[model samples]
Target chain A: MTTLPTPGAVRLGLVIDLDICVGCHACAVNCKEWNTGGNAGPLSDYQPYEAQPDGVWFNRVHSYEVGDGPAGQTVHFPRSCLHCDNAECVTVCPTGASLKRAEDGIVLINEDVCIGCKLCSWACPYGAREFDEDVGVMRKCTLCVDRIYDEARPEAERVPACVSTCPASARHFGDLGDPASDVSRMVADREGMALMPELGYRPTNRYLPPRAKGSGCSAHAKSPALEPVMPEGTGFLGWLDRLLSA
Target chain B: MHPALSVILFTVASGIGYGMLMLLALFLPLAAGPADRLFGAVSLGLALACIGGGLLSSTAHLGRPERAWRAFTQWRSSWLSREGVLAVLSLVAIALLTLAWPILAAPVECIEMTAAIAGLLSAATVAATAMIYRSLKPIARWHNRWTVPCYLTIALASGGLWLDWAGAATGVDFLPRAVAPILVLLAAVVKALYWRHTDGLKSATTIGTATGLGALGQVRPLDPPHTAANYIMKEMGFRIARKHAAKLRRIAGGLGVLAPLLLVIAGGMVPALDRSAVLLAAPVATIGVLVERWLFFAEAQHVAMLYYKADAV
Candidate 1:
């Protein structure tokens, strides 16, 4: 049951645009809010009001400063389950609790059967799985399966909570299996990259690189100032006539 | 890579248990009459207790210990499941051999055949356990060719010491006096080689490679997504200081290998001190192996930490 489906299946995944992401953390927050009430609910937080608070979160955003000084850029990377084609997490599950959907290729864990040995988490290179200590089960991003397929919700809004809630429009959700899909086209156009392709996970999600900064432009480039117009006369009518002529 | 106590205990105890069981199975044909029956009973009892206790202790670390039985289901894909199955099969074989030993006295061939099967199964069970860690490609320290042999050698060495102690206690020189010491030396050499190999090795992935940003200059973490520690940080980002690690390695080496080697050699040379020497070596060697196991988990580096700007995996 843990065996993966054939490659090039309907791999529903996300494509994030790093150039526009401001690291607002709205996606992470919305993920927590929606998933806590959805399939994997109540992502229990320990010591909520205490000095050290810990909890399970399906998605996390990591900000890294790449390069140095002039060429440096702060990259905010939001990491979640990539729903990999060759997911080791699923294969390493001793119980058949972890499964990859042959239909959509979304990986999921059966909480009822999961013994919570933490092997799946260790097997994953991306740190996609989250152990829910309270429920004594492993939790991960389901790609909002409930919302995405629910007929009750509006068709336009049928996307992952993280993708829909992103204020900066940094996240895109579509079938990555299709080469001609919108997300795939975006990836082709922008040269989207896998997070750790060297690891050979074949992650479905792709990240668009930030646009190269022009040599003349600075981090805080300002618009050029307009030349000052000399007033022909001290009167308002004369100033208006000079401004109109200019 | 957090060296959980339950797991450390499970691996060490079960390894020794399985090793002892295998040795007993190999020598089952020699045990005969009332005294030998008592000896076999006691030896087999010890093996079962150690193996069963260790297996039970492993479940204690699980979040849903009650659902542990389901772990036996996925043997095709999971090493842990295969280990569970093999452990049960070996136990069953040993049990059958033990129960039928007295009744099957007429045919020596039957006993030998059963013992052979049981011994092989025991060895296979230990191998399955080793593969659980060895198969993990994400951890550079554990996923290596040396891991399997190192585990097998250590198990045999520990088992040999226990067998020596048991033989000395029971006044039966069933095995050669030199066997235990020689195995201990071999285990020590293999372990040293494994350490040397891992020490010079570099992680396959670098921080830049992890982020797919190797084309850019040095990449560093400006800010972590969260100010507080998360599950990945707690589970995989465990770090040990170099000084402490060095000290622990010395301690493990001295207790696990050197002291046992000296005691076993002294026992072999002096007839009078044989019993006491082996008795002392058993506990000392166990503690050493325990420390070694702890270092194994604590030293492993998970590749996931690369996202946090870890210099290496």
Candidate 2:
């Protein structure tokens, strides 16, 4: 049951644009909020108001400073389950609790059957699965399976909680299995890359690279021409007048 | 890579149990008179106790120990499941052989065949256990060609020590005292080679590759995602100081391999001290192997740590 389905079979995934992400963490926050009460609900938090607080979250945003000095740019990376084509997390589950959907390629864990041995988390190279200490089960990004397929919700707003709530509009969700799909085209056009492609998990999600520094119209863009300021009068009188006027 | 006590205990205890079971099977046909019965009973008892204790300890770490029976259903895909099935099979075979030994009287061809089958199954179970760790591609330290042989050798060496002790205590020379020493030395060399290989290993994936940002110059973590350590960090971010690891390796090698070797040789030289020497060697070798197992988990770096700015894993 843990064996993966054939590749390119309705691979619904996300394309995150790193160029537009503002490190706001809205996606991660919304993800926690929606999933805490959703299918994998009550993502437990321990010591909420104490000195050390720990909890299970399906999504997390990590910020990094890429490059150096003036050329450096802050890159906020949100990581979650990639819903890999060859998901080792699913294959390594001794109880067949971890499963990948052949229909939409959404990987999920059956909480009732999960022994919570934590092997899936270890097998996952992306650090996606979270262990719910309180429930004694493994939790992870379901790609909002409860929300995406819910007919009661408006069709336009039925994307993943993270993608729907991203204020910067940095996250896009669509069928990655189709080359012509919006998300897949976005990936192709933006040259989005798979995280840790060398490991060969064949992650469904893609990350669009940030634009080159000084290439776009921004406040930091240098002006080609400059005009020197001239005082109304020459010498000490002009300098004193300019200083007083400033 | 938390190196939980339950897992360390499980691997070590079960390895020793299975090793002893295999050796016992090989020696069962050579036994004569009541001594054969005594040796069979005692060896099988020790084997069963260790195996059963280890299996129980393994379940302790699971959230739902009661549901452990479900683990056996996935042997086709999971090594852990295969290990469970194999352990049960080996246990059944060994139990039958032990219980039927008295009724069977002297050595019979069928009994020998059964013992041989049980021994092979026990060895297979240990191999399955080793594969559980070795197949994990995410942990660079575990996924290697050396892991399987290292596990088998250690199991054989530890079991050999116990066998020697059991034989000496009963005044039954079932196997040569030299066998244990030879096995210990072989295990030592393999373990040393494994250590050297891991020490020189450069992680296949780097932080740059992990994030798919190698094109961006020198990506460094500006801030972690959470204020406090989360599951990923807690489970995979475990780090041990270099000096401490080196010291533990020395202790493991010296106590686990060298000490046992010396004791076994000493026991051979002095007939009177044979029993005490072999007895002392068992515990010493066990402690040494325990240290080795601890380091195995402590030093393993999971690939997931790359997200938290681990340069390589």
Per-prediction DockQ: 0.68, 0.77
The residue-level lDDT of candidate 2 at A133 comes to 89
Error of 1 at B38 (Å): 2.5
Prediction 1 TM-score vs. true:
0.93
- Candidate 2 chain A weakest ten by summed lDDT: A215-224
Q: What is the TM-score of each candidate against the true structure?
A: 0.93, 0.94
Candidate 2: list runs displaced more than 4 Å. Answer: A215-246, B30-35, B102-107, B241-243
lDDT (Cα, tens digit) per residue for candidate 1, span A1-246: 776667655899999998888999999999999999997798888887778778888888888787787888788888899988889899889999999898888899988899999999999988889898899999999999989999999999999999999999999999999999999999999999887786677888898887787653463577676676865577888888878888
Q: Quote model 2's TM-score.
A: 0.94
Interface Cα RMSD of candidate 1: 1.1
Model 2 clashing residue pairs (backbone): none
CAPRI accuracy category, model 1? medium
Error of 1 at B185 (Å): 1.3
Candidate 2 per-residue lDDT over residues B176-199, each given as its tens digit:
657778888998999888988988
The lDDT of model 1 is: 0.84
